[model samples]
Target: MRYGCFLSEPQGPDAIAGLRDQIAQAVADGFTSAWLSNIFGLDAITALTAAGVQAPPIELGTAVVPTYPRHPAVLAQQAMTANAALGGRFALGIGLSHKMVIENMFGYSFERPGRHMKEYLDILIPASRGEQVDYQGETLKANVRLTAPGAGFPVLVAALGPRMLKLAGTVADGTVLWMTGPKTVAEHVAPTITAAAAEAGRQAPRIVCALPISVTDDPAATVERANEIFKIYGQLPSYRAMLDREGAAGPGDVAIVGDEDTVLARLEELKRAGVTDFVGSVFANRERTRSLLIGAAKG
Candidate 1:
């Protein structure tokens, strides 16, 4: 399994600052890849493209870029451009965002997300791969081909349920997950996606599992801190179902918090449970956790 580090949530100048040094540090510290989120501050593709050119050969990814406002063509173009910029090390991770955010925040219909995702990937996959895609679906239509890409990039769908996961396995390269635990990954996720890929005659798909990590001297306090910070995720319907599937009450319940050895053991369990790419959203004991994880990656 490859180890990736989620870029720390930026503050103040990070919005406009170049990420070359930060990315270099991750590579220097032994991370195989790095993930950036698509928040309001800086777009993931743009940020990664800017920094990726300067960083070493380590991989760069979009933890997720939302697929609501942007057209598949536009996103595909950006993703292909970023891939070229990264010398083919970019992984495009996209998702259907929550209904509340789409409707309330963006004023778009959050309608039939599973179907929407299927339609979105239909256009996105081919078009982003330097192939012409003149397809029309219920939710979207695209007539485009990438004319100037250095190379093709892998895709990772942010999938949760069976329909979404099946789409991810068959249509896309793999799935990039958040807050999904080993129990669900082992019994439900791994089996479901692997079976779908095998039936479709595709190679084993990448299951990139992202989780909050903290190498802490105080596990209880760290868990409580994570609870306060990530509780809102528990309320989101999509995330709630994943949590329920794993029998986790809140984000804190799934957080891998402890000292180095403890966190390492749990991470081993995840790998055994079929997580091919492990991205840690480090929280408490930042440098300590990062340092320990860097060793874990190296070892």
Candidate 2:
């Protein structure tokens, strides 16, 4: 499995420059790819587009950009532009962000999220491929043709549930998972998505598994810190469902925290669970965790 790192956002006046430095450092550390999350901060795609230029050719991807805010046509245009800016090394990860954020914060209806995503993909996939899209679905409608420089970059969805996993495998290129454990991936995610992809005659799907990792002397303390840091994920329904599937009480339960050997064993387990890529969100003992991951990338 390919190993990658989740690039943390640096908060400052020159945050973009800081992000570029981080990407360059990741490249220096021998990381193959780096991911940025799209939270209530700088836009991930825009930031990556700007930061990735100075960094030498390491793959950059958005952990996810919410679909409710940007229309698919607009997103395709932006993603293509960003991909071009990054020398065609950008992966667009899109998701139906949680109901709380969509409804409460964004004031958008979160009804029938699965159907919304399916319709979103229906337009997005073809549009990203530079096709003339003239499709109308219940949740979305697009009638436009896009002429973009970076055509055909892979699109992955933050899919956890069966319907979304099916959509990810059959329609999109793959699935990008966060806060999910190996057991869930082996039993539920891998099987469901793989079957859907086979039925659709598509190539094997890329399952990119991302989890909090720390190579620490105090694993228990790290777990406690992780629980506090990522407590919000335990409440998000999509992530909550995956946590439940893994039989984890919370996000901390699934975090890979321990000595080097222990962390490597956990990564091996994820690889056995059919993860094509592993992105480490180093929460503690950052340098050591990244060292291990960099070695794993070379292996």
Candidate 3:
């Protein structure tokens, strides 16, 4: 099981250089991959492009960029360019973002997002392969081709529900999961994704599980910090259902917290649950940096 690190672009007045240094350190520490979140603060693709230039040999990717914000062809071009800039080490992870963010913030209709994503992939995959695509779906339409061959960048989908997982299996290289626990992964996620791949006669899709980690003797405090970090996700119904299935009272309840032994145990549980990769978001303090500690564990 490969272990990786996941972090957002740093938050502060002057954060770019600091963020680059953090990415460099993760690469130097031998992490298999490093991911950036696609959110309001920073442009993930740009950050990753800069990080790729500074940190050679580290796999860089977005955990996801929302599909509603950009057309599939545009996203394909951006991803191809980034993958080339990164020397063919970039994975393009895309998703249909939350309805709240899309409908309220971006003012795009969020209904039938799964269908929209499926149509998006119909264009995106072929476009990434440098093929001409003439696609017309209810929500999207495109007739485009890349002028040059893409870097053959792997596409991962941010999938949670059944329909989305099926689309990922049919079209994408893998799935990137957030806020899901080992038990729920074993009982729900892995089975659904694998079954879909099998029905399609495709190879089993990669299952990259993103889980919060905090190596602390005071597990309660660590959970508190995780809750604070993930408070917004708790309010979203999609994520809330996943949390409930994992027997979590809230988002923090699924977080990997405790001493080193306990944290390692949680990680092993994920591995046993058929996770192809583990992207850990380490929450730590001034006294004990969980990122450094968990990075060391990869060795």
Candidate 4:
């Protein structure tokens, strides 16, 4: 399994510079990849561009940037620039964010998100490949051509539901999943996504699972921290349904919290379930982070 770390774009004094330092530290710590979360803080593309200049050889990616926030053409432009700045080591992970985040936070209409994403990809893929896109859909319409030749960055969709997974298999390079447990990944996500890819005559689609992990002696305290950090997801209907189907009562149940051996065992369980990549969201301690990354790299 490939090991990575998620850098939160914390908003405060010198946030962008702090992000650059964090990315540099993660790369120095032997992380294969460093991912930036797309949210209200620093724009992921800009932050990554700065970090790309300071960091060497570490792959950079967005955990996800929501499709609702911008048109595909716009995203394609930004992604191409960032990828170029990073010397072609940026992965663009796009998704339809939750209704509350889109509508309530960003003030966008959250109607028919699955359909919107399908249409969005239709434009995004072509544009990211530096082709002209003249497309119209219920939610978005675009007519633009990329200025650069092409970034050719791999695109991963943040997919969960059946239809979206099928779309990712058919069109995208892979899927990026969060908060999904091993059982659901094995029984529901892996088979369906790979089957769809096979039906489309494509190679097996990549399954990148982002699981919150912490190597802590105090497992209960670590679980509590996970619960607090991911509490908002439980209230979101889509994520709630996903967790329910996985037999996870809450974020605490899904978090990987234990000693080094236990955490490695859980990660092995995920790999056995067909996860191609593991993006570790380390939240317990800096020492634990170093231990997990070293262990994962050696493994």
Top model number, TM-score: 2
Can you tell me which runs of candidate 1 are displaced by over 4 Å? 13-18
Root-mean-square deviation of candidate 1: 1.3
Residues 179-290, model 2: lDDT tens digits: 9999999999999999999999999999999999999999889999999999999998889999999999988999999999999999999999999999999988977888
Please state the error at residue 133 of candidate 4 in Å: 1.7
Cα-based lDDT for every prediction: 0.88, 0.93, 0.83, 0.85
How far off is residue 275 in model 3, in Å? Answer: 1.0
Best by lDDT: 2
Residue 102 CA displacement from its true place in model 4, Å = 1.3
Clashes of each: 0, 0, 0, 0
Ranked by lDDT from best down, the candidates are: 2, 1, 4, 3
Which residue pairs does candidate 4 place in steric collision?
A: none
Query: lDDT at 70 for candidate 2?
Result: 92
Candidate 2 Cα deviation (angstroms), residue 123: 0.6
Alpha carbon lDDT of residue 260, candidate 4? 82
User: Tens digit of lDDT per residue, candidate 1, span 62-112?
Assistant: 989999899988898888888887888999999887888889999988878
Better of 2 and 3 by lDDT: 2
TM-scores for all candidates: the values are 0.97, 0.98, 0.94, 0.95
Write model 4 residue lDDT over 146-232, tens digit each, in one string.
987436999999889999999999988899988899998899889988989999999998899998888889998988899998998
In candidate 2, which residue ranges exceed 4 Å CA deviation? Answer: none
What range of 10 consecutive residues in model 3 has the weakest lDDT sum? 286-295
